[model samples]
Target: MAEEKSNKKTNIGEVVSDKMDKTVVVAVERKTQHSLYKRVIKRTSKFKAHDENNECNEGDIVKIVETRPISKQKSWKVEEIIRKAK
Candidate 1:
């Protein structure tokens, strides 16, 4: 039987930096319970995403999809802008 390929992974986060050309850093924050302490903790992970048109700005909420590596540190691409920054 042939298996269907699933779509690439995607993440939603707020854009933290847009100083690089065609690239932006997105910070995704999540809350998780400590493994043993049973306490809730907040964690943040940053990812570099490619923006073809350089449309992303700092503080914008964006969706990013995993893609083939476009650079040394970029394996994600900007999929859409979920919300505009105030």
Candidate 2:
């Protein structure tokens, strides 16, 4: 069970929204190179993560882990706050 939990997908991203109760929106950005153009491009993905303590705020950096669906849109949970918002 512990090993299976350890294999869950995780993402480090900045919290984009924290308006929902016990939920926060995290935007994870990644850089990918254009196959033909050979240019690096930035891509962002937003995820709704469960924040049991409501400790996250907009602009805060947080680590989120995949978990069982807690809501219709939330399948991720906040693991920890990496950085606080200024």
Candidate 3:
């Protein structure tokens, strides 16, 4: 059997249900170590992404990635809409 390969990437985020039609909210978190202080810090960002199928709901964690512009500043699209909100 041939092994299928995918060059896709995934990002985790929080699902926010709003009146924006087929869109969900995603949060990206990053941790960096301070070079001078030698300490670690965390940074997070929330993004509004498009989910046409509504497969993901509020509080659901999902994976997304950079893609062609679906809309203004919407180059980041959902790669996989997670079924469970973990």
Candidate 4:
């Protein structure tokens, strides 16, 4: 039998902060319709992602993938930089 490998979860978001060494905070926003109000709403979530080289900067669009916990608040790592910050 062959072993199965599950795919990790990924998210595309903007880097909100990168003041920490080798770490960046990403803000992922999503649009969804309210269950009761039936109105579209924008939801934002903050995630702590590991940046091995600390190349991310504020306002940069990046992709993050789930991984083994590296710290108390970091369970995700920056996969790639989608867009550079202006």
Candidate 5:
């Protein structure tokens, strides 16, 4: 098998809003265990990713990849538009 490519991995999130031009807001949520308490906690963060074209819309699940800074607070790019909003 060919060597698998490994780059900066990113979590998939739903597109909460895509009103901004060339920019989209993705909501990524993850569960982590507390170091001492050992209790799982749900943490969510909104990421501003660069979308070259206006291809994604609200409620769409998409994938984004980490990349060099394209603008202020923008270090990620949309990789693909996975699913459309239901």
Candidate 6:
């Protein structure tokens, strides 16, 4: 049989903090239109993701995937480092 792929939730965001041991904070931004005014607005959500190798750095672009909870606030893990910090 062919191998199966898991349908996990994923998000691409920028690393806002890499101060924690084996973890990093990523800020995901999305744009949505206001319900009443129809005005576009930018919204940001921060997620604490596991960086097992501690390779991610602040300001780096990364892709994270949802997984079993690792902590109170960390249910996501770094899937890949999209771009390194300059």
Return the top candidate by lDDT. Answer: 6
lDDT of 6 by residue, 6-86 (tens): 799999999999999999999999999999999999999999999999999999999999999999999999999999999
Residue 33 in model 5: lDDT: 100
Please, what are the lDDT tens digits per residue for candidate 3 over residues 11-84? 77766653576777787888999889989999888777877776777777788876667887566666785666
* lDDT per residue (tens digit) for residues 31-63 in model 4: 999999999999999999999998999999999
Candidate 4, position 59, lDDT: 98
Would you give me the overall lDDT of model 2?
A: 0.95
Candidate 2: regions farther than 4 A off: 1-5
lDDT per model vs. reference: 0.97, 0.95, 0.73, 0.97, 0.92, 0.98
**Residue-wise lDDT of candidate 2 within 1-86, one digit each (tens)?**
45443778999999999999999999999999999999999999999999999999999999999999998999999999999999
> Where does candidate 3 stray beyond 4 Å?
1-9
Candidate 5, superposed: residue stretches over 4 Å from native: 1-4
- Candidates 1 and 2 compared by lDDT, better number: 1
Q: Against the true structure, candidate 4 has what lDDT?
A: 0.97
Q: Ranking under TM-score, best-scoring first?
A: 6, 2, 4, 1, 5, 3
Error of 4 at 64 (Å): 0.3
- Give the 10-residue window scoring lowest on summed lDDT in candidate 4: 2-11
lDDT of 5 by residue, 19-56 (tens): 99999999999999999999999999999999998899
For model 4, the superposed segments whose C-alpha errors exceed 4 Å read 1-6
- Candidate 1 has a TM-score of 0.90
Ranking 5 against 6 by lDDT, winner: 6
TM-score of each: 0.90, 0.91, 0.73, 0.91, 0.87, 0.93
Which structure is stronger by TM-score: 2 or 5?
2
